[model samples]
Target: MTGARPRNRKELLAAAAAGLFARDGFHNVGVGDVAAAGGVTASALYRHFQNKQDVLGHVLLTGVDELADRLRAAVSGLADDPGRRLDPLLLAAAEVSVERRELTALWRWQGRHMREADQKDLRTRVGSLLTDWLAGLRALRPGLDPGQTQLLCFATLSVFGSVGDHRATPGAGFAELLARLARAVVGVDLPTARPSSDQWRTRVAPPPSRREELLTAATRLFREHGFHAVSVDDIGAATGIAGPSVYRHFAGKSELLLAASRRMADRLTLGLEDALATATDPADALGRLARSYVDTVLRSDDLIAVYTTELANLPERDGRELRAMQRGYVAEWVRLLRSVSPGLDEAEARVVVHAALTIVNDIPRTARFADRPGLAAELTALTGAVLDAGATQP
Candidate 1:
């Protein structure tokens, strides 16, 4: 029998590592596993990569490079027609997102595992891509201020990137669907009224004891730094306690992560229940849920960040349970969306829901707009537009 043609070992190894890291997370996957997946010995893998971190950096940076190149090709000749350029730009983004679904997960969650220098380089490259998009957006909407334009750019990227958040396979026209949703995001009329002082009030009470203090500190640390990067001593220092003293309140770092994640999950569940209880109709319920979600994110941004990005660091059982809760929450939104617009199929509703949620989840994390006046209102409006785009689609 004729043997298959040999492939480049380095490319094979990177591909294998990307899939494993995206699926199992960086901390969970070992170098030997990556080597096995690539059909190579550990020694052979070591010849190409310094370590697993090196593999991860290669995977993530390569993905970024590919995206930047795709985007460049997307708008090659449309420089003068910034308004018309957005369609092709969005389509190109959607195409790449579908082709490399693993990239979204790697870029968002796995980058934190990289060394400091690599992480900075990654951000700079990604920022350059954003800057190019921002210039297009500025020309497309000359009336909008810099802040508004940047926010829209971020939201548009989030819509395309949201694909990695779920596994639901939509039928034909998936890329076009994402493009349409992104177009809606680009056209959103952000609200301008500054939020009143009372609107900024947080519902979370101050830590009532040393244990609560430690949990609070841990959540912040984990959000700012990856869970693996932070130590029990760091959490203790934040709360003025010794490293060993933290054990009295929580079993270990893992327990602290679980507790913090549980707190976030519980708050989201409660918000969902409240939205359901008071809504008079399906549309009303969705609107309520959107506003409630924005409020929750604004009030507990750090915890929300930790809850979403640090799940892979949690104990396996806790991760599964929290993931189920997350699914239930998303399912409720899908149900309400379908009821509101029976025209949308199940797959379409799920995709649109993810897009809207991603807009809210991602836009606020951008430092420029995180504390902007009336941000919550703008996010709520943008989210509504995303959902409306789905409802009106043929």
Candidate 2:
């Protein structure tokens, strides 16, 4: 009856765990929650997963299977040209990313808690996946290394993940974002901005601020690179502070994480509060809010990454508050949308608002104007359009 029936049971557990994790977060969801959702006991869940992390490990591995299968099939439908295949693969990957955002976030979140071995395995699988996909892209691109390729790859799938995380419309403008990622990765000569030795010493960045410099620098570094990819020394070096001195400012990277998260949560709620007060109407409010959000995102290509990737690393209480803050923001948006429509009840309004917010939240993923000659205005127009639709008078 129980001959290692982990895959089937595991998929159910993963799906259930993903729902709860996405609903709350990793730290909030216990083994019992996952087991209950899967209609099994915690003991049963443990059989497939050593712990919550094992659930995430399966989600990640499942993503590889699902995305690779989808990409391979989707790529077949595209023209042989590398540029053409890029979009199709991106579309397929984006779809999967949206469908899988919760687990994807978990997979990302695990960077905080998973053992070093699990983390290494995850990296290896990811690199192998990209190396294979990049092989298809190799004929079109030359001279790109794994580092560059990996960044571009992360940028590609991440856009969709953001869309899903933020709730982008299933079909709206997804293709455009895909095109942008493809073009940016291939068409643009985006040479990494390496400073000369003297320049590195001069212009890389100033020494850490005397006032909360260590914390600020660490947050920026973790956000700019990644929690796993960055180190305490990197933060210290960036800010011209002592690595050990980081302890004076904060307990460790995890504590620093909560601080960064608190900053974001404060901003999110504050922004929403301010936006609502000034808004003339719900739609105007939504547009203004969406505009502000997009503006922030455009300036911060790494903003969503900070929210999605590192939030999990924060200590438990802080992470809960941040999630609550986000929920409140979304809930506020939904309430405003309902006021605008009057036609939809609260639940219906939430459905509509969430769908729209998802798209608005996805600007960083799909926006290409930053690189496009006149694309900024185009992106602005698109941003306005979504806000308008969400905010438009009934």
Taking every candidate in turn, the Cα RMSD to the unseen true structure, in Å, is 2.2, 8.5
Best by TM-score: 1
Q: What local lDDT does model 2 show for residue 313?
A: 64
List of clashing residue pairs for candidate 2: 166-358, 167-358, 168-358, 168-359, 208-239, 283-391, 369-375
**Model 2 lDDT tens row, 79-121:** 3466667656766665666566666555544444555676677
Where in model 1 is the C-alpha error above 4 Å?
1-7, 77-79, 201-208
Query: In model 1, where is the ten-residue run with the lowest total lDDT?
Result: 197-206
The Cα RMSD in angstroms, rounded to one decimal, for candidate 1 relative to the true structure is 2.2
lDDT (Cα atoms) of all candidates against the true structure? 0.86, 0.58
Which runs of model 2 end up more than 4 angstroms from their true locations? Answer: 1-208, 224-231, 251-255, 299-304, 344-377, 387-394
lDDT of 1 at 358: 87
